[model samples]
Target: MGYVVPVRANISSINFHWQSLVRRPMPYEISFRWNDPEAMDEPRANVSYVGYVPRVESVFSVLFPCTGRVSAVVSVDIMLNITTYQPKQAIIFLKLKRSKTCLQGQPTPLNEAANDTVRLVLGGAEQDLSLVLGVTGAIGVTFVTLGGVMMFYVRQRKAALRYTALLSCWSLEPEQRPQPCDLLGWMQDLSASFDRLI
Candidate 1:
């Protein structure tokens, strides 16, 4: 018969102790596995040992690999299998214990380098944006300059036309004076030009 044991601890190392009930040596097999939910197809850690037990008790320890320290309580399972010549032929005893290790400190060099790379990329993007804004500002200024020049040329042309109309009306001979309609048209043109200039 076998039994399942539930263990809860902040574990870093697992120690296993077992002994045979009989006074003589015996052959045994022990397996240890760590199950991870993220990887259902395969366990994260698997260890197996097959050897003969001496008359005295046997003790062994397995250190689980960890990238960093874990503070939270975790659950794990321990399984031990034994073979004997006959059923219930040998007495057996198993003991399991957990030990904790502390690893807390500042950021590692690799992490610092990664953070610096991210900052550099963001800085480069900001500089590129500034350059684009500078170009856009220059284009806007050029457009404003062209608009002012166009307005100046248009005003000058209108002023010249107004002066020429006034001179033509003055130089006409008394008998060659414009009809009432022609005079009215010239007056309307001069009034519009003055309005636009003001």
Candidate 2:
């Protein structure tokens, strides 16, 4: 039973054992009680890490030739989000009951239905705000420094090209040199590129 539903939380991986008992119509009530339940609100349905027990439904749906009860020890992996603010452990309570209704349309519990509890120990929060902030600041500084160095290198390259072009024009005979209009246009284009870099 490795199946699990996705949840929204900074949850580290966790592995635990769970059991399922099916007497009649299978339905169960599951509740998680934090050691300090008063501090936290009840988990909403959307964020609750709830999942179905795999293969239990299909196996239990069949009618048997002889009457008997079925029980199984299931391995379930549930991802629960723990925080620095919460307790280190929790108790999971389960109540197995019948989902079938009576003649009066009221649901009833099975006589042999049982309850179970599993102790879950959660590791402490592995990171804090300072670690995150430190990493972020280091990355920011690295990018800024790299950008500055790149800009300086580009400026140097452009200056070298400008100087080489001017020296080439000076070395050429006056009549062979570029037309003033062409030189002006080229200067304007270089200025435009410089402006873009700025």
Candidate 3:
């Protein structure tokens, strides 16, 4: 049978075998993993690498599918901050995991899907970095400055103290916390936390 995919789908419902039909996405890194009950906090794909986009050509890739009941599409969508300079690589990868047991498993994509899915898409998009930055960045800057002023009025907000509280509850041995974080980028104040951690 043939799988008809939309131009863009939610990053949560991706499958590995659909690589061929996938539209070339943002030039982002990709990795895949099987579900794992033991290490819910760590990435099970055990694969990590950077992606480079010479020309954002049409994208296609075929891999195994998810074995477990729930499906997830792990992706990174970055709109570049610089004009004229494109990202190195941008694509999404499907990682498989079991929802109930949280165990990791891998299923292969069908042959036809595999054959049709892996090409990169390239060309200039009608994106206005200036507008995005001007609007979103302006809002962020306003809130941050306002927040700083508010912080002055309120009690001290100690990030170190709060993060310590989180680490204190996390088990060294794996157990599924209702919301486990496999993606470090998805963690709470991860960027700032990293600054504190190191």
Candidate 4:
């Protein structure tokens, strides 16, 4: 049998988020997570209490078998004395299950938003908000450009018809037809005339 990693009272977990858009430091939430509810209800491990074996490293782990479930439980140990701030901690028990067939013992699902999972939205403070917003805006622009390119490619098969129609109009000389499309306008000043059809 494997041994449980120890947790102590003074010891705590820390998560920090910095948002550059609003130039602010988001809230820092500290907490705990473990494989077994029984094991986590009362933290058995902390800074002072080493487990069955003394580990010189700053980090330790405890693994839990999930039976036939898709996700595995995990516990990571860290020293509590290194941080300046601490907060109230709470544990959430998740009993919700998957509707589709799930593989046994897969890694935990950690998307940006997942129910019954540990998620903290954090970022920089007001001073850094501009930076964050800059990055976000850049990303938004890139996505728009990509979407436009995709739309163009998807419509490429039909674009030939539109191009052919325009060519037919421009091919006639101004003198040969009634109100011919001003070819000189296209050859000399395309930008001014192109706006009509665009």
Candidate 5:
């Protein structure tokens, strides 16, 4: 028999299986109990099958249904009832342990025996970073470009203000005021002298 329950977000499902090593057909019933007392209402199933080979064993697998996110470690107690030639029934308990990461499609073996638990790992949803990176890069480039334009504009305004102040100072001396053409020629001479000195 088998039991099914909701698994955590990281885990997609759990694959549980058992094998009968006995030579004859064995009637078995399996039940599951969770560590959490609140999850007492777990699903269980029964099976009746026989073992034909001595060393070889038949494997029976079941998937545990996953529902919501599980943050803590979940411990499951497996109880098995095997009916043999004797009138009395034999009970066996196998402990299955699961963590949040184990459910992410990674196959985890519970026991060393070949008939023990084998988990199947499921891949989580992939996140797209291309769009986010593109947008961020675009914003950064725009900000840098805007800062450069503003700096250029401020430098141009400062230079124009300095030139205006120099012109006003020259105009204040009415007796020494130079003609517009002479002023242009004087500015060119001053620039040529500065360049030669440099």
Candidate 6:
């Protein structure tokens, strides 16, 4: 997640709070880089917490030049880096405030600012794997049931067609009728075909 500041507004300071929810003590770090598409390359901003620490609440008062034009909106990219092996979660709160001089020779206060919070989770792959397997098994069972129903429908259609053909043949005149032995042989052949299909 990222935050956008107003164009041409001076970014005087950025404050952040980092907390870890791991039972055992572990080292962690946070840093951010500026991503400007118009520039040749993104430049990294220096914050206070480069070294590894368990938890930190830091503020950076470095001057950030607003390169955005009057009518265009520019964004800054902030990235956080955490180093830990065990399953853990962290809550980060960030605030960006600016101060400037007004037309009446007055210094505006830092009343208006951009604020954001983020929650990071790490290492929960086992639960995800179980969920995926459950969904896959359900899909497999659905497809197998659908296939059985389709096969049953096809068999019924074939039997109906054979019966219809027999009835049409029997409707013919007596001189053109099929013999009883011939009808019996045809029925036997149809049964054998159905057995083979099944």
lDDT per model vs. reference: 0.46, 0.38, 0.37, 0.35, 0.45, 0.48
Give per-model TM-scores: 0.35, 0.33, 0.23, 0.20, 0.31, 0.36
Q: Across residues 1-198, which tens digit of lDDT does each residue of candidate 6 receive?
A: 334444233333343444444444444444445544332123233445464433433333233333232222334444455555443455434333222211222222334343323233433245557767989999999999999999899889888867887888789998787788788887788767866766
Q: Relative to the unseen true structure, what is the Cα RMSD of model 4?
A: 17.8
Q: Which tens-of-lDDT digit does each residue in 1-198 have in candidate 3?
A: 123243122111222221122234334455433344232222222122444334423333423333443434422221211112333343334322222222245333234242323333333343445556679999999999999987764433455554564575474445643255553533546546554644
Q: Which residue window of length 10 is worst by lDDT in model 4?
A: 93-102
Top candidate on lDDT is: 6
Candidate 6 TM-score, C-alpha based: 0.36
User: In candidate 6, how many Å is residue 86 off?
Assistant: 16
Which regions of candidate 5 are displaced past 4 Å?
Answer: 1-11, 14-18, 36-56, 85-198
Question: How many collisions per candidate?
Answer: 0, 0, 42, 29, 7, 0
Q: Is candidate 1 or candidate 5 better by TM-score?
A: 1
The residue-level lDDT of candidate 6 at 61 comes to 29
Extract clashing residue pairs from model 1.
Answer: none
For model 5, what is the C-alpha lDDT against the true structure? 0.45
Clashing residue pairs in candidate 2, if any?
none
What tens-digit string does per-residue lDDT give for candidate 5 at 1-198? 245343453343334444444445555555666554332224233233232211233344433332223333455555544454322444343334442222323333323222224542211112124545778999999999999998898667666655774577487777777677687776666556544643
Top-TM-score structure, candidate number? 6
TM-score winner between candidates 5 and 6: 6
Off by over 4 Å in 2: 1-127, 179-182, 189-198
lDDT (10s digit) by residue, model 2, range 24-108? 2222233332222222222222222434432231221100111112221112222233222222233333322211111222112
- TM-score, cand. 4 vs. native: 0.20
